[model samples]
Target: MSIFGKFHVPSSAFALHETLTAVPEMAIEIERVVVTDEVLTPYFWISGVSPSAFETAARDDQTIQQIKKLDEFADSALYRAEWTAQVQSVLYAYTEIEAVILEATGTDQRWELRIRFDDRDQLGAFQDYCERHRIAFSLQQLTQLSQPKTGGQYGLTPKQQEALVAAWEAGYFETPKEAALTDVADELGITQQSLSKRLQRANQALIGNTLVVSAEYAAPDAPDPDLKH
Candidate 1:
């Protein structure tokens, strides 16, 4: 069985920790990652700061080899970063254990990550790798799936799944007003508040599981011994 895990690590335990600390208000969402020969190249989206400010802060981060801005928006920018191969951060640990990063977002204080591993042994190996490297993390959630394809539902509870489906069918997610919240609640035989909460949780689960798992970069056959802590 595959395991889905969610956890948090202080900024000090991952790549770009210094950059995140420097820009306390900045938030980062990892868009994609490619790991090869212990080197990690990740594309990320940054908001709440300007590109120049982020570049300046990144200049002092020891984990980064290079960073290039790919696009810019009014409040957010996209960037591609190459991490130093020898840096033993949690990202490296993910590569070591062959874990797929489902979602990773960072703030100055900490990073919240959701990852899927092949099995319990792979998950255990990830934890062991973190311990060996002295990388501290807080485990938030753990779920086991009998098969991988079953993750389409993202571990939503029966009631949550039902509420979400009903709401969608009622057009509660439409851009223009197709259905009102109260109407969806009535259809589900639940209060508006309960329906809202269920929808919120369901949406979060969908995002966390579906985002950033595509376009995996091929890794080498064996881990790099030199990169081991």
Candidate 2:
């Protein structure tokens, strides 16, 4: 069975953390990360204001200084680097465990990673790796993804169920809007785009299931006046 795990690790123990911590106004949402040899290539979005400081920080900060190249795209930035031994350890752990990160985001305080693994063994190996690294890791949620969605969460998948519930509790869909998409996404341990897609799908599923049958033309058994045999 596949395992979906939401985890947190301190910024101090991770790369790109310094750059984020330097700009509290900035929220970084990772689009993708590739680990190879001793290098990491990460593509991410920088939310908030347009940033000039990113280039400067990449040159100045000890962690970010390791970056070999930085490319700015229309919607996101990408960095290529030979990471530190510490960062290597973290990435290597994923390899040994057959795991992949589905989503990751970081603020000044910490990094949240939503990772998926092929099975329990991979998870156990990853857990041990965290313990060995002395990384202060917190597992927020874990579910077996191979199983069918149950619990009558309105036919929502586990991640969708969690995201919808989190958004509602955080008031993302409420009157006057108690919370913004950023806040709701942050609370749900996902990026804003990911959260947007999840909420969209959830809303679509709910509306389709609840209201489709009520349409005047929806009933299958009713005689169709427009149809002639």
Candidate 3:
């Protein structure tokens, strides 16, 4: 299964606006306006923006009244009032960022989250928010590769075997492939340096066993000649 979600944010909130703008092509539009708890004061109903132009206007800080070329329903006076309410609500800090939870498939779960901020100050706040909530976050893009020989292989642990097999398939011998040791490490949930060391030890054992078996087989030809004589 895969899941996707869109998070709504108000343009008046500079912090959120900056964050949303950094994401390509995504836009926020006012959906409804409301007043929340007394302590929180103002609140807004917002959803993703459509028609692209509306998004452009909102990001450019154009007044809702100035946005003349809106969709039929969107251009109406009632809609303009709603949009104004949304902007005002955000200015007063009535809305806060709720979590955007997207249920993803095993493969999609591996997707690396790439995020950017307007500047260092916003970056610091975002980092703090993620850390406080213990969110597993990364800016790098993520991909997943399947391994065929992963089930019940050697006496090695799942992580150890995954590293070993990935190394083998990638050709540790004559020439290296485009495969990343770090990818294997990340998939197996281990450190790259540690996985490398484990692969090395595994290689040594495999080589030593093959050499020993070949030597024992070579002794058979000489012994068989005595029996023929």
Q: Residue by residue across 158-218, what tens digits does model 3's lDDT show?
A: 3334566776676543354556777666665665655665575455444544544432111
Residue 5 of model 1, lDDT score: 90
TM-score of each: 0.67, 0.57, 0.23
Report lDDT (CA) for all predictions. Answer: 0.70, 0.60, 0.34
Q: Write down the TM-score for model 1.
A: 0.67
> Which candidate comes out best when scored by lDDT?
1
RMSD per prediction, one decimal?
10.0, 14.5, 25.5
By TM-score, how accurate is candidate 3?
Answer: 0.23
Q: CA lDDT of 170 in candidate 1?
A: 84
- Measured with C-alpha atoms, the lDDT of residue 34 in candidate 3 is 33
- Pairs clashing within candidate 1: none
Look at candidate 3 and tell me the lDDT of residue 181: 78
